[model samples]
Target: MQDAKSTRITFLLFPGITQLDFTAPAQALSRMPGAELAGAAASLDPIATDSGFSILPTHDFASCPPADILCIPGGHGVADALGDDATIDFITQQAAGAQWVTSVCTGAFLLGRAGLLDGKRATTHWGYTHLLPLVGAEPTKARVVEDGKIVTCGGVTSGLDFALTLVARLKGDTVAQAIQLAIEYNPAPPFTSGHPDRAPAEVTLGLRTHVYDAAAARMAAALGATT
Candidate 1:
């Protein structure tokens, strides 16, 4: 058996993945010096991100090695990806043996939908946080919540915070703090907050409506898939 320390890390990608949720954490994971990082998905082709970035999946699920750490990034495709048997089955199989399962933004929806978040505290992008419980999470508002083997983040941008938290946990606080210091990342926004509380009600409502529309559209398309 591979020692927990020796296990490799792989990030899972699905169509319509949120760019920051996938990239920021992948970057942070790579900061661990010798640790290996891979983007694994249903296909090794380029996957589309919600913010319009394109990421090439380096490993296809069929041939990818098991993960010690796994990341799931959410996007507009959650409804469809959640219903995808191949996508969800692969996640289920990989997550079963992985040391930790993590997600950013609405990606938690896919993880929650996969039965991974049942009775586990998890979160998604604030735009659709309520949906986490609709799927299965206890719905956390924290930028990052490490709930045993399950970790989740609140938004696309928070993915950076999630990665920072994960690194501190996985590699130790000094390493994590150094990274934070190196990045000059002591943040204090004039807005005084980071969630709906920080933003105006109108802004929050508009964002929520948009996310819901996307999720609903995907759900309509996923009606009969086996995921």
Candidate 2:
């Protein structure tokens, strides 16, 4: 049976969001009874993802319902949004009253840019965790870090785990477990390259790209930081 009170989950949409970060969590939360899902953007238009897909925004900034939970998903567009006032303001406003404010990957950077993660223990994509201090957040290395009302998960696939955690928080362990079982949420990777610590040095170095450095520069420029 659905709960008497529905939980409103709003995901912030941008031009180049990583679709999995939003979709994974959206799917998990939607499975919870009485959970309402929405995708909000600056305008009511289709938004593109880094993975060559597009998703339509269901609500615009001014028209979005107050969020019970506000989620931000990360992608290459994150650097651009770090300097976007409309995006930052929307997050600030919605998060103020949200029961839980959460993010996946560098989505935490958006929360940090909105000044919500200041002094909060948070996590982001492994490639960008070092940048948390750039926005006043205490960087954490956990896959999912929950500090009060804020819950941040690391990297792309972590959104799945993060959403399950959110369900457990809002509902109960039993409900969360039931949902987990329904989805068959089990991860068994064939290799050990999930994290920097586990991956071989050569494997990690080979995969490293300049994209993060460029993004970091953009973030610094947007925040008026000298570095």
Candidate 3:
């Protein structure tokens, strides 16, 4: 049975989405005392994720209910999604009524494309934070940045942090803490190079040379074409 005071949390599903970006937060938020989760896509068809698997969406854009919290998750597909009018429109419409508008990873770009991030302080994957300015957003450095009702987080794992933060805000710290304990959301990475700042210079440079430099250029081109 649905809780009478349940908060409707909706996630936008698309091809090439970073599964971790969506799943991490969904895992935490779904355990919230009064949370209801929905994954919406262009259709009810299964949407392919970056992880080489497909997820079936709960609703189509036209059928999805207005969300109390609307979240967009990012991946390589985001560069292409930036150009999809229907996706942007769906985000715009859902955000118009959502109590909280948010995104994980490059999903912030989708919010930016929808004009929701205009003049707002936001953050995304470190590799693409520089491009936030193209969307009229002031780039911020943090795991999660909150600009009033709009919240954005960096990269994939940050979604878990963002979700717990939101749960604390909407429910209570105790409830959020309980959820965290239940999930055993602990982190002990072997490497201290999660962020560019801490990562070895050579490692960062090599990653940029092979991946981010070209990826960011494509993102820039996409944002340029849209804006």
Best to worst by TM-score, what's the order? Answer: 3, 2, 1
TM-score of 3: 0.98
Which 10 consecutive positions of candidate 1 have the poorest summed lDDT?
Answer: 218-227
Of the two candidates 2 and 3, the one with more favorable TM-score, higher being better, is 3
Off by over 4 Å in 2: 225-227
Task: Give the alpha carbon lDDT tens digit for every residue of 12-36 in model 2.
Answer: 9999899999999998899998999
RMSD of 1: 3.5
TM-score per model over all chains = 0.86, 0.94, 0.98
Model 1 Cα lDDT, one tens digit per residue, 1-227: 11245547788888877787788777766766456888888887888877767889889999988888888887777766877789888888889999889888877877776788888887776666655656556877677888898989887778888878877777778888877777777877788545778778887778768666566545534533433
Better of 1 and 3 by lDDT: 3
Q: Write down the lDDT that model 1 would get.
A: 0.76
Give the residue spans of candidate 3 off by over 4 A. 1-3
Best model per lDDT: 3
What's the C-alpha lDDT at position 18 in model 1?
72
Candidate 3 least-lDDT 10 residues: 1-10
Residue pairs clashing, model 3: none
lDDT of 3 by residue, 22-79 (tens): 9999999999877889999999999999898899999999999999999999999999
